[model samples]
Target: MPSVHIRYDNLKPAVKQVLFGRLRLESTRWASFKSWYQFSAFYCAPGEAGAHEKGGVEHEGGRFRRKHLVPPPQVDSLAELNERLAAIDVAEDARHIHGRPTSIGFDFEAERDRLRPLPDDDYDCGIDLTPTVARNSRITVRQGYYSVPAKFIGQKVRVKLRANELWVFDGRQVVARHPRLTRRYTYHDFLDHYLEILLVKPGAFAGASALAQARAEGGFTKVHEAFWAAAKQKAGDREGTRMLIEVLLLHRQLPAEALVKAMETCLRIGSVSTDLVAIEARKAMEGTDDDDAELLTGDGPADDAGGESAGQEAAGARVISLHARRLPPDPRTTLPDMSKYDRLLNLGTARETSQNQKGQGA
Candidate 1:
């Protein structure tokens, strides 16, 4: 998600005009393509050079690509490509190669001028970006499901879908694209997408519509259902479906092991409350701090900045200690007593009456 913060007082007029009064830039000079461009249109005198007029984009792009892209060994995987690109960016930004006299790093540190920042709102360029997958596989977007070809079930098919239109791609090859539906409930009807989701959580998705159809036509539902049933039994939770859904949601941001632990905790408790699962996942993530049990239990002191209590093993660890002090005597002891107090005071007379009766009997 891209977020933008706009402040007119810090923005240059040209950039502001481009943003159309919708956003603000954070700084007067900002880094683009590894070079700095000064936003001069806002504060410059008439007939002075502006951002585009100074050939800023052209100059910056050339230096950035040359410095970052052409490193010695070529990268192969997309993951490696992105990693290498980041490394190059860090290195170039740290040095002072661009005849700007000061290191780009130092200049950034020293400068405090403001322009509009990047907008936090999702930008819609109107280009279709559907990631394609095989007919058997499933892909997710915004917590919803979509389908692709079955042959590509295990393989990755890129969805080129944007916020509006959905597209799928098998590498550079475009397979299928469609306009995304406005609602989420309809997404599950996409057979291939449901099949893919079933692969991850067969128990919860066993009776799902797509799987039901596949079972009727292909006779595979029994096998899948058995697997899901076994998984549910192992988890020992009646709310397997809810737990599975929660696990899927968490898988987006957490590691597989952490999510698995979270699911286990949810199943054990027979509840899929997001709050409880999050607590367990954090505990699993931090790996059971022996000195910070309270942290894991979510009962650490409000001011426990030192994660010291985070792993405390004791159930009732004392975070704060109170000192012993003398207190004043009760004022009621010095005051005259009420009639109720007289009854207790007359207990001796009642006992003597009982004794006199016993002596007369004797």
Candidate 2:
């Protein structure tokens, strides 16, 4: 882009400051514009001096609305609407204008070849902010609340605000990203981010914004609901909700598809517990059924197996065996003679009687 022609009123304060070589304006895209593109800016005269300056831009806007916005689109999300508009733009590129020999797309292709390639690094088009996460692990940006991991509560984080997205950074690391909400006071919560806190406060999980969003978005599937209900029936509500939170936390370590499949298996078997859910999830992730047999039989690899050997054990290595061994009694045994034992007993008795008679005489 060689230059940009803009009306005085349309120029942002920062841009105006840069154009006029003034130091009053705060830092913003004006600095980026000078550093990144180095394009010449032409400002039209104020008011009636340049009434027709933006006539072409106005005409193009009207044409776009007439061509594509005559029938408004109904989309579930801003992303969907943007996708539709992008498709429309691409389609319109093929249109031929009056008196033009080539289509718009052809002309654009010819002109695009002359354009400069984008820089290696992307420009920061988002506003920077530092907001502290609240006790609920939620931060407010542009009046829209978004959840972060619970561990970040009470900690300040940097937030980058784009037109349709919010990127949160802890120092240089991006901790979370959310679709920017256009509605005031609306919240966007991610259930996975709050699972740790939910485990400690299971009652709140039932009414939390994160859980509500998960339910609305179909992330909380029927399997999840069934598992929760079964767990609640087996245990009380609090314990059951905690169990559900544990199952949900598995999503952090396991692929969500695998975890959901495990939950479905649990629901089918009428066995719902955190331990069972974790075991099922591990089985699903490992893509093996050997653990099922081990679990059923309450037997695992023998303790004598070395760690490395145990790890190398075949997936199908599950076998049971029973054996018994006896030792023979000692062979050097003989029966005693009853006659010699009786003679010794009679002699001892007679000696004791003689001793008693002598004592009486004395």
Candidate 3:
């Protein structure tokens, strides 16, 4: 085709005017990608001559989408959707295309050896954006809000947004990343991104959106809760939460599973020292197998600028339960009597009252 319509701001425009927009120039993005993929493009002459070639490609793709993606497959994530598509492609390979005597698989097998391997490095298909960080430490991208570091507030941070993830850059470093928000006007945030500001405003943390989201997403687990409550009791709420925030910063240095196990150990010993938590987390890391221990980096800093952040693995991973890693508490152990447990039956808050009145009243 002679022209392409460029979507303004890489977003759906308010005016329904795709038929007329900025005139199609050569695509810088596609040109860059062609070099990486080592592919050539052959465009036909304008008007009727090129129309057949152009329409056929899109028509075939539409047919595939309508056949395989109609009614929308129920999937938890994009990765699952990709898996479904792969399976569908495999299933389709058994069938022959129109006028083809051999199956698609058979045709592919004949030419498979000629296909070159993909480039060693992944080609980033994301759009580079520079959104200003709001006072709430968030940047609005595609009608959704996402928190950055508080330090970036009132300043522009480099951002790269892909189909499933968004990565924020500070100069040459990846400071934060989050799953791309699907719902319009919704935000996905990390607690660590706000921990610096929360240190000065500890009281705000209890009601923070990040903290609530963390709990909902299981980044702040029951272990972290217990530690926070203990710290709050030992110190005041303000100080305790501050202490917890300090411990939270340790995620930058320790793997999430290891840190959680350490927190559990410290809680068991009735200690809330941040130092103890760090020491215990390190000990847990020492015992953990290197291959199994992947650092939960979405909560902290990502790699240097050289690496492109992919949203595929972009979500904050839930805390792995450590209950089975250690022995279960002995069930037959005696416990101090709790009168409230007996009060369910209106049994006068006493076990003796409950014991004698077993079947006397329902």
Candidate 4:
């Protein structure tokens, strides 16, 4: 099977528009390719008369029939039909033609050289490179940085770079070229080229590589460490112990100010649970809705709603009292001392006499 890739460059836009309307287009047949390239498919039979001369079976024979030979059917719009046809042509060409020598199916392989060359780097493939400058004086491209000339600072400069290489251009002239870097913090040092920009926006780390380097060498961790140590010191022993957690939680979406307020409330109540902090933070903004209040305060609906409610509330308090009685007191704080005399006094006279007899017998 013979196939050919025809570049639509020679055809005028008007004529090309008509052909595209008649034929189907494959936009992503080579998706990596810019939109300038297009293709169509054809099939050939062994006995077909024009098999060798016309580059196998032209897949677009139906298009020729519908558009040129037969009564052209009315479409929603001529332009719309053309668009549909351009896409269809691409899809048809994207398929593997039958009776190929190789089983590994790739159209580029069979008719490799026949396809049109991609437009030259200079060619404006109608790509929207609408120029805009770097506000931060640095912009990240593929985990690397190519310094823009000093003049392009604080203004948009068009970046035209291809795979494995990048160019920072000031309008027409190429300002900088750097092999793209891939890791975080491994600075693509056009330092000589961009040191002035760097001096201005010291905190504005552009690429992943630069960010990683800053983390590794720029003391971000040390700053946090110093802050935490100072916090722990100020919190004084156990009170400041939760400050470490506060430090970490601050990194999340909840504002630090809200967290500090929540921590202060926690400290006031002598309770420092991270879970509690989150709950209180949410409560501050949106007052605890019915369910949350009920949960936190252990307030629930009375079984006898119509009856005297005070007794039920009292009962609930008593239940809480009983549970508290069963619970072990904190080891860190003072509690009632248990001694032999205390037990005897609590037991009363008859029990004391029995204890004395048992002690004597022992």
Best by TM-score: 2
lDDT of 4: 0.48
Residues 128-174, candidate 2, lDDT per residue (tens digit)? Answer: 99989998789988788988898999998899998778999878898
lDDT by residue (21-106, candidate 1, tens digit) is 33434332242311222232233221333444434545777777776655644643335666777787777667875567888777
Report, for all candidates in order, the number of backbone clashes.
46, 0, 0, 22
lDDT of 2 at 132: 90
Q: Scored by CA lDDT, what does every candidate get? A: 0.51, 0.76, 0.76, 0.48
C-alpha lDDT of candidate 2 relative to the true structure: 0.76
Candidate 4 lDDT, 245-321, residue by residue in tens: 34444435575455555555555444555576676666555644334344335565433443545576567632221
The model with the greater lDDT, 1 or 2, is 2
Off-target runs (Cα >4 Å) in candidate 4 are 1-25, 28-131, 140-146, 180-189, 197-362
Candidate 4: minimum summed lDDT over ten consecutive residues — where?
A: 9-18
The order by descending TM-score is 2, 3, 1, 4
TM-score of each: 0.28, 0.72, 0.65, 0.25
TM-score of 4: 0.25
